[model samples]
Target: MRILLVGAGLSGAVIARALAEAGHRATVIDARAHIAGNCHTERDAETGVLVHVYGPHIFHTDDEGVWAYVNRHARFRPYRNRVKSTAQGAVYSLPINLHTINQFFGRTMRPDEARRFIEAQADTSIADPRTFEEQALRFVGPDLYRAFFKGYTEKQWGCSPADLPASILKRLPVRFNYDDNYFFHRFQGMPEDGYTPVVASILDHPGIDVHLDTPFVSDMAARHDHVFWSGPLDGYFGYDLGRLGYRSLTFERFRATGDWQGCAVMNYGDPDVPFTRITEHKHFAPWETHEGSVLYREYSKACGADDTPYYPIRLVREKALLSQYVARAAGTGNVTFVGRLGTYRYLDMDVTIREALNAADAFLHAVQANARPPVFSADPA
Candidate 1:
């Protein structure tokens, strides 16, 4: 069977490799000149420092299978994502933890005391929150919400917290103690070399043929028996159901002497601040030594036709449009939609790879059983 995989990101690369290993012909194509899409990393010509072209992606996950799969390609260095926030003329830790709570409110209460204190501070009146602001208030009350989430989320989404859904804050971690590890994933680290090399190695197989600077058109699928599309779902249908909403980013790069903000991610959690966070690229690769550092001020805005969509806005209109695309993709036989763009959900690198692996497993199972695989790997429609 000949399979045409679109967009040579993690999802496409993984699925393509799986199909090829199954004794099937797989052709992977990416519009960009590189294999890794937004996660593309390359050495800076002047500084010689490896830079993440889109944003810093920290490899962190608790799934043993996912961790083992990536480890086969490259060794991972021990790394933790400890983020800091600059808000209201001061810098503090993130995720509404005990340290963040004490620092922001000028209180040194113990964990139990702090929990009780926050419970009292919480707004019990709003039992069920419909918006982001109300959700924050119910969880941590007004003061902390205003200090941490309210402004930053507004800046990131380009909308007031009241206008956004409370589901946005679902399952966000909050610590009782001073443990400031950003993610609680069991396996958390950065690739030894970099993401680009690791991704390149994943697509390095004899049976798999990769074409960079190549875009997959609908006509390309005619020659192939199956299609695995990682591009935008609406793009597959040519936006016939109207374009899905997404938030995009613009990175302003600059060189600076000494440390910038003393951390990798320094978020500006104030509505007045234009950018949501500034990331110090040099700090990302902690093993490397550099005199001069590179930083990126990440500004988020509504996505345009030409712009790359960083985060999907899963609002009512967008969800309805996604349903239409799902229907179109389902009706169109032999084509499967996978990954963040196809599903219209903002997925981290780990989640994307995880889904890809699942898709491969499902495809193999279907091939053996002589059944049609579902259009999506994670969830259908």
Candidate 2:
């Protein structure tokens, strides 16, 4: 069987590798010049710091199989993401932990004490929170919400918190303890050499052919037995139903001598501040030390026709448009929509790889049964 993978990211690469190993010839193509999509990483030419070209990607997941899968390709060094935030002229730990709460209010309270104190601050009136603003106010209260969440959410989403869904705030958890690790996943680390080699190793199979800087055309699908599209769902259909809402990012890059922010990520919660966060590339790979540092001040805005889409702004309007696209995708034959963009969801690296593996398994099973493959392996709904 001949397989066509429309993107060279984790989803496409993993599926291609799985099919290639199963005696299927896979052809992987990407519009970008590089292979690893947004996860693409390379050593800085002058500073030698491994820069996450698009943005920072910390590999963290609870899935044992996913953890082992990445380890097989790349050497991963133990790295925990301890994020910090600057708001109202003070630096505080992220996720509104005990330390952050205590520091913000200038009160050194124990776990139980802090929890009780926060409950008092919360707005008990709003029983059923519907919006991001209400969720934050109910869970953490006005002070913490205004200081940590409100401004950041507004800047990141390019809208007032009242306009965003409550599920957006539900992603982040508030802890009574002082543990400030951003994620609670059991397996957490960074690729020792970076993500590019991990993906390069995956696509190195003899049955696979990779083409960089090559865009997928509509006619290309007819030439292959099956197509696994990791590109945008709207893009595959030529955006006839109108463009899906996405928040694009713009980075202002700069260089420093050593230790710029003293952390991997430093988010600005001040609405007046233009940029959302400043990422120190050197901090991402703490195992290796270098004299120079590379950083990017990230700014988020409405995704334009030319901008690189980062976050899916799945507001009411976007969800309606997405449903139309999903229906069209279901009707289409010989193609399976996979990955974050294809499925129209913001997926983490581990989730993306897991779904890709599942998609490949489903394809192999369909082949065995002499049946048609699914349009989507995971339900977008």
Candidate 3:
């Protein structure tokens, strides 16, 4: 089968490579000029900093398979994601650990003390928390939630905490441990030459023909054995079921003389702050030192036709819209929706690669058994 992978991101590239290895012809294409999609990283000519072209992507995964898979393409350094949050005019370590709690409250409490203190502060009234606000109140209490998450989250989603689902907040770590490493992944690191080089190499096979700066959706109507679409689910069907909501980011970049924020990522949790987070590119690659720094003040906004979708705002309405898209995808023969935009869901780089690999395996199995390969990689419902 000649597999047409309609995006050169992690998902498409992985699946493309996998399909080619499995003795199938695979061609990868992307609208963007580069291969890595949002994870594209390049050297800043002026500042000599490795700038994350789309945004800062911290590759962290617990799955050894996924870690090993990525490491094969590019050598990874020992990189731990350490995030900070700024609220009420002070910066604190993120993931709401003991240090963050102690610093936020102006109390030098130990891990146990802080844990107990938070439990006491937590709202016991919210028995079965449904909304984001209630969930946060139940877990970290109102004061902490308000100071750290409420406004920031509201800004990111463009909806009040009460309107949003509790599951969104679940992604955020509420830890009692003194350890400040944001992710619990065993192997976490950035690519040696950055994401672009890794993804470019992944799609370098003779079987894979990359048509960059070329949108695949326009040519989707053309004949192909199988179309692996990694674009937005809604866009595939011409938005007939209405546009699916997505939280997009606008990167406000600036050059600085010295270290900015002293870390790779910094969250602005205050209502007064307009941006969701500020990412300093210099600190991302610790092996290389830069005299100055380049930073991106990430502002979260609603996604329009022109805007790039960073995060999927899977609200109730969006989910319903996704359902229609999913149904449309299934009925549409010789096409399978994959990746973040394809499924209209939030996915990390590791998860995307894993799913793509799984999709390829399942596809091979389907061919062997004379069954149908999955139209959608993961369940949208």
Candidate 4:
């Protein structure tokens, strides 16, 4: 089979490599002159810092298989994400650790005492929290919510926390202990050579043909035996049902002589601040040292037609639109929707790779059975 894989990101590269290994000729293409999509990383020529061009993507996953698969392509240096946030002219540790709670209240309380204090501060009246604001208030109390989450959530999603889903707040945890590690995953690290090389290595199979700076047209699907599209789902159908909502990011990049924030990520929790976070590129790869430093102040807004979409704002309206697209996709023949954009969901790098592997396996099985490949191996809806 001649497989046409659209968008040479992690999803496309993984699928292309799988199909190629299974004796299928795969042609991978991307509109951008890059391969890693949002995870694209490169070296700063002037500063010698490995810069995450899209944003900071620390590769952390509990899946051992996915971790081993990534390590096969490039060296992964141990890097733990320790995030700090500034709110109301004060700096505090993120995820509301014991130190953060003590520093905010000006008391060195033990873990149990801090837990009791937070419980006392929490609004226990709200039994079943529905919105993000309610969840924050119930879990961490009003003071912590306002200082840390309210402003940040508003800036990140361009909406009030009351309007957002409770599930968003569930991703964050309030620790009674002093552990400042952002993620509790088993394996956490960044690629030694950066993400671009890892993705490039994935697509370097013998049966795979990569065409950078190539835009995938709808007509191109008809020319191939099968198609694996990792582009936007609404884009595939020409947005017949209205455009799905997404939050896109804009970076204000600058260079400094010495260390700027002394951390990989420093989030601004005050809504008064225009940007969400400032990520210093040099801190992401602590293994290498350089005289100068580079960083990006990231701002999030509603995605425009020309802008690259980052987070899927899966609100009520967007979910309805996604369901319509999923139905249309199911009826569409010879094409399988894959990846974050194609599935119209926010997916981490590890989940994206796992799904790509599963999708490839499903395709190969279908080929052996002499059956038609399904529109989606995993349901987007």
Q: Model 3 over residues 1-381: C-alpha lDDT tens digits?
A: 778888888889999998898888887878887888888899888898999989888889988999988888889988889998888888888899988888888899877888889999999899998999999999999889998889998898898999999888888887877889999878889886789999988887887888888886656546567888888888888888889988888989999988867889989899888898899998889998889889999888889989998788887788887887888888887788899999887888888999999988888898899888899899876
Instruction: Quote the lDDT for 27 in model 3.
Output: 77
Model 2 C-alpha lDDT per residue in residues 125-234, reported as the tens digit of each score: 99999999999999999999999888998899989999998999998999999899999999999999999999999999999999998999999999999999998899
Off by over 4 Å in 4: none
Better of 3 and 4 by lDDT: 4
Q: What TM-score would you give candidate 3 relative to the actual structure? A: 0.97
Model 4 per-residue lDDT tens digits across residues 1-381: 889999999999999999999899999989998889989998899988999999999889999999999999999999989999999999999878999999999999999999999999999998999999999999899999999999999999999999999999998999999999999999999999899999999998899999999998878888899999999999988888899999999999999998988998999999889999999999998999888999999999999999999999998999988888888887888999999999987788999999999999999999999998878757776
- Least lDDT summed over 10 consecutive residues: which range in candidate 3? 216-225
lDDT of 3: 0.87
TM-score of structure candidate 2: 0.99
Best by lDDT: 2
User: Tens digit of lDDT per residue, candidate 1, span 331-362?
Assistant: 98888889999888878788899999899889
Best by TM-score: 2
Give TM-scores for every candidate, taking all chains together and pairing residue i with residue i: 0.97, 0.99, 0.97, 0.99
Ranking by TM-score: 2, 4, 1, 3
Clashes of 4: 0
